[model samples]
Target: MGNSVLVFAEVKDGRVKKVALEMLSEGKKMAEKLGGDLSAVLMGSGIESLAEQLGQYGADKVYVADNEVLKDYTCDAYAKVMADLIKANEPAIVLYGATILGKDLSPRVAARVETGLASDCTDIGLDDDGKFTATRPMFAGKAYVDLSFTDSKPNMASVRPNALPVSPPDESKKAEVVKVDVNISPDDIRTTVKEVMKTAGEKPDLTEAEVIVSGGRGMKGPENFKLIEDLADVLGATVGASRAAVDAGWRTVDDQVGQTGKVVSPNLYIACGISGAIQHLAGMSTSKYIVAVNKDSEAPIFQKADYGIVDDLLKVVPVLTEEIKKLKAEG
Candidate 1:
């Protein structure tokens, strides 16, 4: 295999996802360490324009698979293209962002290429011998394990979003673009995407949000979530909920953050009224900073929280929001 690193640059709403750029930034470092080239692949219709942005981030080469059949995400089409590309250019390391699309696409491609994949990795690097190593959470965040690929041609790992920082792009850089021919017919795809409907909200996805303000059963009723929303709005943060809040129908499942829900690692995670169950902590234990608010001073969340507030969220949240609003106004 060639000592090159390849990154799958995922795109959403005509823009490259931040995590993809982050992977490319890290991929560049890996490529330099391996004394090889850093490449990226963009797959979607009318996405050729995005290849230049990838190059600026660090991709020495950009592979474009732009076709009508590849417009929407399909397991068969994407998997086939990715597997074929890997087979054509045997890179030493392959990186994918552990987003919803990456989570689904990486496993299929790995199976097609007959390689083992480490998923939801928080860290990745090369050992002194130039072997790829990945660190991933285990046992519900209670432990972490480092994995190394053995007997695999290309080391593959799906890194979690926000796990790595994105380096600034260099506008002077340009990438050599390669367009892949779409050979698959409609018969290859079993599913059809007729229409795509998106939820109407300006808030970012829970998994990708930088700041999250979450509430639990202590919010009392669904209507009481207004407090959480108020705080989230003032802070320009996404609103999240514990499983109990979702179970009580106070928030939608998309807003739920826990073991049974979405895993998130935002910069600032403010938990209000959540008791911080192990299952919940498992999902967000990797957050950069965690602040828990609960009336019960002995809540389990305090054990894991960087800062704890022993007070009623109903009163504390509104005051906190007003204080932030005042601070913003003063600034």
Candidate 2:
């Protein structure tokens, strides 16, 4: 019986990503429920210093595999390190974020460990018999299915970003550090991250935002996206787009929301001018509250939206923004 719950702490620029903190928080809760210990594995070069932060987020133990090869993400390198960790630790469950790196690495690691994997899961928990059960969307978001593994030692899954909330970090507790050196060889890796480019903007990351305002083909053109941005800015929310909009070059891939893009389950998801596609719903149907503004009342998005405003979004959105501002001012 190795550690019961182990979360992979994803790092970028020597800092832990928010999604990793969310995983740690959820992992801690699950560990407590199962009467087990929570351990987090942080892998990256010069990331040992961030282990204490994991402790604040509810990790009982922090395992650091600091290596130069991990300075930049390579699917092969990450998978190898993760496989070795699982082999050595034999945790009852392993969790990864369903981001690009996780999508690339988890399947390989699962194969290496010879275990079944649930990808893009919305929720996970221990069933009545202490079995690991994962819940995921099925049939293109029309239904959800729960899966349980009977014989797997370390049940693994990659959760969609923003599906779970990050608990407040408790700074009082200090977790024990276990530093392990994985003797990685350059000859074992096939890919390399030679250069990295970043978008310079003040806007929030769609996947991690608390509120999101998204547009679709209904916006008609890229020039009209300013309305979407203005509304998002007023609410301090992130701007997103449906695949149709992104494919049309109205937005970048980073701002896309759907099965093929980033998954966002924010507190509020506002879809204006988006004629809902099944793939788009798969990413955001789990949102706490959904609001749709479109001219077509028959649009599929209305079915999932908690509040549906059937009207031309161009006319409705500006009024909606004015009302929101009025309410805020009154408050």
Candidate 3:
């Protein structure tokens, strides 16, 4: 690796994740600015063939550390492999997607390599001096700060999922594939993977969702959330809930959208029965469009809503769902 910008190319099932491709796009731009090559580091079992796809997204080289032990992600084994690779390659910068796996893995890798990491970053760029700079939300998404790693080589940052644009792939581009045997011994891994329990749903991931339909305490009770779910289904959208709704047992914590929960930036956000507290706004204020439905016209949510409907959600959501399905069927 020569003066490289390296991205952690994450894969799910048998395909590379969209966020990883987005990282490659951004990393490619940064690599060009720094006059360096862009590389992707991938770890999995029998995934060497997937390296070819990384080039179209703009990687100059692809490093594949394929092994049976690496098939399932174990914190110790994964971190040790990445840490060792960073020490050897010493790329100018490293990046990962701020997904669940990324959030859990990046910090450990950073600490293992004795480097600082900026997590959930919305923006990353180079300073006038060509130093790496990262910008992330703070104060419950109420504030942001630009940071740089002055003391460390190969500075690291985890880009927030969907925060960056997904660039068109260049099929003409090809990256050199370098296979490395991390050879993580059984003793090296303290944690053993047993069985994975999957969540029972076909819903899209909240962070990666293009459209989201959310509810709050105004949903009244758990059963009322079916209305929110119905609307989400009509729009092919993910379901989200305000912290108040989650705390009230109306929705699961995983569905919570706020400072204490998930941060999402979707193409469209529909808020039903939500009061629009600052904490909740912090999570979804960046969405492209916001539609709020509540009985109280003076609710704080209305202030941030691009479209507001002043009526009881119980009366409105079912009608809206039916209309949406009708329009879809008509088309």
Candidate 4:
């Protein structure tokens, strides 16, 4: 097997996703450590122009599988193309961003290639002998485990979004693009995407947001979520909700953050009136900086927060929002 590292650069709405760039940056480091080149694969229609952006991030080579059938993501077509590429190239390492698409696609491709996959990895590295090792949270973030692939030709791992830092692009860099001809027909895909319904508002996806402001039972009711939203707006952060808030019907399930919901690692996490439960902490404990606001000083969230405010959220959030707005105005 070749020692090169291949990254699956996922695209959305004609633009390369940020996590894909993060993988490219990380993959570049891994490739160098392994004494090989870093390459990327892009699978989408009318996405040939995006290869240059991949090169700017650090891809030495880019494989483009552009076809109309591949316009929208389908389990059958994407998995077939990715698996075929792995078989043909036989890279030593394969990296994927643990986004919704990555979570769905990586396992399918690994299964087809008959390889072991480490899912939702927070960190990955190579041993002295260049063996791939991945670190993943277990048992609701209470523990972490390190895993290594055994005799797998292409050691596969899906890394969580925002787990790694993205490197700045070098515009001078360019990649050697190779076009792959997709042979799949409409009949090959069993499921069809009849329509895609998008949620309202331009809020960043919870998993990928750099900053998050979350609410819990202290939020009181659904109407009170406006405070969380206002704070998030001033900070340019996404709004998240603890399971308590969701269970209380104060927020939608999509906004829930806990063991039963989406796992997120952001640069900053603001917990307003959230008394940290183990299940709630499991999802966001990895955030770079945590600030907890709750009336109860004995709240469990204070134990994990880098900063804490012991006050009523209803009284504090509005002041916090106004203060942040003032700071922005002054700047």
Q: How accurate is candidate 2 locally (lDDT)?
A: 0.87
Candidate structures ordered by TM-score, highest first: 4, 1, 3, 2
Residues 1-331, candidate 2: write the lDDT tens digits.
5647999988876778887887888898788878889999898888898999999999999999898888888878888888888898888889988766777888999999999899988888778877888999887677899999868778899887778888998989899999977777888898878899777676657766889999999998999889888899789999999999999998999899999998787889999998888899988888989999999999999999999999988898888888888999999
Position 264, candidate 2: lDDT: 80
Off by over 4 Å in 4: none
Q: Over the full model, what C-alpha lDDT does candidate 1 score relative to the true structure?
A: 0.93
Minimum summed lDDT over a 10-residue window in model 2 is located at: 199-208
Q: Candidate 4: which pairs clash?
A: none
Clashes per candidate, residues 3 or more apart or on different chains: 0, 0, 0, 0
Error of 2 at 254 (Å): 4.3
Q: How far out, in Å, is residue 205 in model 1? A: 1.3
- In model 2, residue pairs whose N, Cα or C atoms come closer than 3 Å (at least 3 residues apart or on different chains), thus clashing, are none
Query: Compared to the true structure, candidate 2 yields what TM-score?
Result: 0.91
- Writing each residue's lDDT as its tens digit, candidate 3 over 13-71 gives 77788889989998998899889989998988989999889988899999998998899
- Candidate 4 per-residue C-alpha lDDT over 120-156 given as tens digits, one digit per residue, 9 for 90 to 100: 9999998898789999999988989999988977999
RMSD of each: 1.2, 2.3, 2.1, 1.1
Residue 92 accuracy (lDDT) in model 4: 94
TM-score for each candidate, following the candidate numbering: 0.97, 0.91, 0.92, 0.98
Q: lDDT values of the candidates?
A: 0.93, 0.87, 0.89, 0.93
Off by over 4 Å in 2: 200-205, 259-261, 322-331
Preferred candidate (lDDT higher): 2 or 3: 3
> Per-residue error at 181 for model 3, in Å?
0.9
